[model samples]
Target: MKVFVFLTLLACGAFAQQGPQCKAPNGGGLQPVLEEFVALIPTDKVLELVLTAMTSDPETQAVMEFLSSSEFYQVVDLVQSQPAFKSLLEFACSDLYLDAAYYFNILAGIFGFPEVHNQTRAAARTAGFRGLLLDILELIPVDELKALLDQKLKSDYYLQVAFQKINSDEFGSIIEALQGDAAYNNMKNRLRGLGVDVDLIIDTISKIFKP
Candidate 1:
């Protein structure tokens, strides 16, 4: 798994070296890079690798178990009970979501992926994804979901254990391997070219696992 991640990073560094071709499109930028990345490594294979790694790690298994616990359901219930959240769900079911979907379809067409555009349009019309979300919102019992948020915030055992695993030397070694000196420099330079604040992003992500 570590080897695969390291190779993937190296491939991305090579892609970063392709000067003009790596540039973002007229209205957007990341899509072209993403397309190139996807071309090199299929999305399904990436997802498979991620799932394999997660399932093989005991700490990740604990985190996944916690996510499916009753307490997590309480968290979901609390969020779903919020008027603001409900409003957002309603908005998603509105024409605005369709507009965004159409916009993405246009982008797919522009990027020379007619199959992607056609599939998206077909799914937008036939798939009941939006309808299912609306139904879930309507079915949630808001009164029952009115539990205090503090009750859920009190437990940090599983999260703390997960963070410990993330901050461990084993995990750090994996990160170091994936971010080898050359690959790290190349990524930073590429992100800078795209006007990203690499230091700020690194700082923000680093804080998440801080003790």
Candidate 2:
């Protein structure tokens, strides 16, 4: 199980996302709706799709309307694991795929939870939260990121290389956010000993938020 790092985000941006775009001449290729939520993806190659998505989506408004409370995050969680995602994950598995615990660690780092609700935005609504995602990441702090990295290493050796590029101060914030939690730090220390730089974990989270 390797903890995929921030660099992967840029790659994810470049590739990874492949979903229906617009209604295609006859009103097709829309996001899957079970009643539904919107996740935008463009048909372009080598482009930043998430940024494009935040601007024009209506499902976002639908999500926002139902957001605003406990159920809000719940829905985000629901969306995170939407069965469709299993297929997406399978589609994306080639770049980095970990089985067992490594996969769970990566899942923890992902922000499937919604940040807020009822806040309307006119910015393309389809653009998704590019900046907001980055800002929210600082919200997780440093140590937790380190601990997460450790979990990744325990499962995936290749991730040790990924950990080499992060910055320390950034990682510290995650630790501080964890408030010296024993479990979190224990994981961090273990990873650190393996030469997994705390900075790499920070960089990955930063990218994930922005990605």
Candidate 3:
């Protein structure tokens, strides 16, 4: 009996030294658990919940009102009339911009995101300012004036320099105007009412994506 007890103790020590077996059971993994979780929530129900939340938010209403206001159009006009803005638009319509976008799409393709590459190519070619500006010109009766200004803007170096200088000096005035606008203030206050800590959200998102 003593010899049997000693042999049993020896076997137990050997098993402990060999370490725990970690073989997963057949058909057991994270895939089934994820499927089960997804099955618990219907897609339509999820959409309904998100839509309800957005519609109930006062900030959403405020944003809609601000978008429909005359002040918004005035602000757009002011920005578009600036020389720096026109320069930016000209750059957007250039081939160099398309080349940069093509490189970005290639990088996306390298990362196993072929859809992003395809969408980027489509958007860069069709949805850019070149096409949009042409469409707008066709709709309006300013084709001759637009052609004249386009020629002068492309050829006049001194005019471009003057506009760049004015843009640099008066950029702050844009912010000042927005700050004094009633619709802008109302939208800002409504967004503040959501009570979310913007900095905390940004920090958390940064940490999540940190390498």
Best by lDDT: 1
Per-structure clash totals for the candidates: 1, 27, 0
How many clashes would you count in candidate 2? 27
Candidate 1, clashing residue pairs? 24-29
What does candidate 3's lDDT look like per residue over 3-49, in tens digits? Answer: 12111111111112122221113322211222232344344543443
Ranking by TM-score: 1, 3, 2
Candidate 3 wrong stretches, greater than 4 Å:
1-54, 98-211
Residue ranges of candidate 1 with Cα displaced over 4 Å: 1-41, 98-211
Better of 1 and 2 by TM-score: 1
Error of 1 at 81 (Å): 1.2
Q: Residues 17-71, candidate 1: write the lDDT tens digits.
A: 1222212123222223223333543345444433553455444345445444655
Query: lDDT per residue, candidate 2, 1-211, as tens digits?
Result: 0223323321222111222222223221111120021112112211233233334544433333343345444543453344333333332232222121223233233433332111112133223333323333334434544444445456544343224312334433432434344444454464354333455545654543231
Of candidates 3 and 1, the better by TM-score = 1
What TM-scores do the predictions have? 0.28, 0.21, 0.26
